[model samples]
Target: MGSLAPDSMVRRVYRCMCGINPGLEAPTASAKTGAFAASGVSREQLVIFLADTLRGTAEERAPLIMAMSQCGTEAAAAVTCEQVAEFLRDLISTVIQIVVHRGRLQGWQPERMGDGSLGVKLLAEQMCSELKPSDQGFCDVSSLEDFIFRVSQISLYLEMLVAEGLNVSLSGRPTPTLLPPCRETPWKELRCLLDLPTIMFLAPQLPDRYSAPWRLVFSTQLHGESFTRMVAGLSKRGPTLLLLKDTKGHVFGGFASHAWEVKPQFQGDSRCFLFSVLPRLRVYTATGYNQHFMYLNQNQQTMPNGLGMGGQHSYFGLWLDNDFGRGHSRARPKCTTYGSPQLSGDEDFTLDSMEVWAVGKPPEPEEGEEGEGKRSILDVDPEVQAMMEMAGKTLHSQGLREPEEEQEQ
Candidate 1:
């Protein structure tokens, strides 16, 4: 070629760099990576390019974060892990100063401070590949120091930002709207941005909806007595069904076969009750993160129906009075027969005893409800009961039998 045109030269270089025929469409990143490695664009060059692109501008950074958080592709993770680390290290320092100086010094509530701090913490964790115990310790030290120093520098600039509500509040205020009334912030919007899936997986009962549920059953071994105790404890709280299988190992494998009707009480005050059972529970309420349930009893008093109803306070009080010996008691009978007596000493009883606890003596057994009556699985419409019995038997035959073999028999 005597003198290649500018366009021809560019095309040739692109084709050579990507190992694609000039006439063919562009190769994918995988193909390009393989080709470039052969032609001498080292892995380091690709990483550097990715890092530069991630740091380009707000327009650029938003797309990169969205891609890294949402896309389930290996390439996205590889690119994100490499780039987010450096970005996070820088972001952490800035966040620390903002939270410590602007929030603490200005008399912001701990919840508000925590919200800002958690955002920084989450960002830092996301940037790192694995957050181990050691990394957590390091983060604690760094974050504490950052908080303290920032608190010392509460200035006019910080006050303006607070007035404008451009910070995250611990009480689950959305980002960029720190101290605004809860109703004004975009709590649901930020949750959507976080891109946490609607489900999660853990052997016991799935990972409480934060981690996506893995459909496969996981086996955990338990001692016969311990397993029985666990089942009994769970049954007292709700209807529990379990399976114990011999996996041929030293450990006797166990799985939850079926749980009877533990419905999520999404209405009224019951939402808080459901969240109390999990290690970590995050709900996207209309205002922001529903932090009310996290430390309800510790930080604030329990609202009438056991919810932090915020401002919608109801005056009427209802108490469950269980007194078998005393005449004319107002207590409602505990629904289940299992361990109703044991609940009298539960911790939650102290704050909202009216809902779940008995105020006085146990309820007297009515004439018809005297014996150890068993609710027949048969009583549940024939189709449903048959299906459940079939499932229970199938599980039992598969080596996962209930401790009391009579149920299966």
Candidate 2:
């Protein structure tokens, strides 16, 4: 009989790979060799097999890392794309044999690099890929491209989830929640600083709670509305995230447990915090003392609307006054109310770009939880707590509900 077609071979390998469980280690060499042999694909054919199978690198990092670990190869050292593909094929077929035929998960390990740094490897819970069905007979060029794009989107979204520390170990194995970033846009620099993985680790979603996957809800530049007007659509959504770029090239924003409302009073609980994304990814959760300190008031007619960036007083103000060209606000930047590394506001910088996203779910109070609200930081620095004391007292003492909206004269 004729040898199996290249696509057939790839399907076989993919089937084997899918069979491997995330919790197991890589199979032995002899077993791997035998699987490929059974598939009728020689060593020379591995590259062609891989080229015909996988595509896209930006979101393929997790799968590639796992494959390399199983094959006892490392990608830490500079390697060509072809070499990486070859490595994946070798591991896939071997894994298929061990997991499918033998009915066992691959026991994968991180590679030890030349400098002794442990190479990147996916945790048992993080190995989620939604590639084309392995059993599917054949794929056309357009179909393959479409497949790669979908996979890339899934990978990007997963990375964002992981950044929020949603990966929890269950049954002695880390299990990540089911889900679903790369693209060119104005927020690139901000996102780079606010790395998705870091966000996952720092601000994880609460357990058993419903949180809608984050989606870009508003863009001041694209929407061409004042911040107050933009928030109209966003306020109705669940939790909210605000990302801003000042004219000075500074990128920062805030995460609020409360909606972006134009109430004439400060109306958020302790779930509001600020962050700076350009210099680095750091989150400033509520100081707790300022339980009701967030507000959105339309500033004086010419001055722009006022946003309480959350602090003791109204320190961290992100005003969106006039619409400056090129995705920026004409309002001056101000210092953050309570961010770790204070976010300084500059009057010189117009709003560069402002993006608002509706996060998964609105935070709910739990019995004996660290605090209230999902965005509430369980751990607070002693210094920060002490500093915020006076500010907290001020908020309580002064009836600082909302900034006075200019009366319609």
Q: Give the lowest summed-lDDT range of ten residues in model 1.
A: 192-201
In order, what lDDT does every prediction score?
Answer: 0.25, 0.41
* TM-score for candidate 2: 0.39
Which whole-number lDDT from 0 to 100 does residue 227 have in model 1?
22
Q: Give the alpha carbon lDDT tens digit for every residue of 174-196 in model 1.
A: 33322211112223222111111
TM-score of each: 0.21, 0.39
How many times do residue backbones clash in model 1? 13
The residue ranges of model 2 lying beyond 4 angstroms of the native Cα positions read 1-175, 178-210, 299-304, 312-314, 317-319, 322-339, 344-348, 362-409
Candidate 1 lDDT score relative to the true structure: 0.25
For residues 148-247, could you state the per-residue lDDT of candidate 2 as single tens digits? 4654433333232222222222244333322212122344323222332323322453221223445556776556646555667477565677777776
RMSD of 1: 23.8
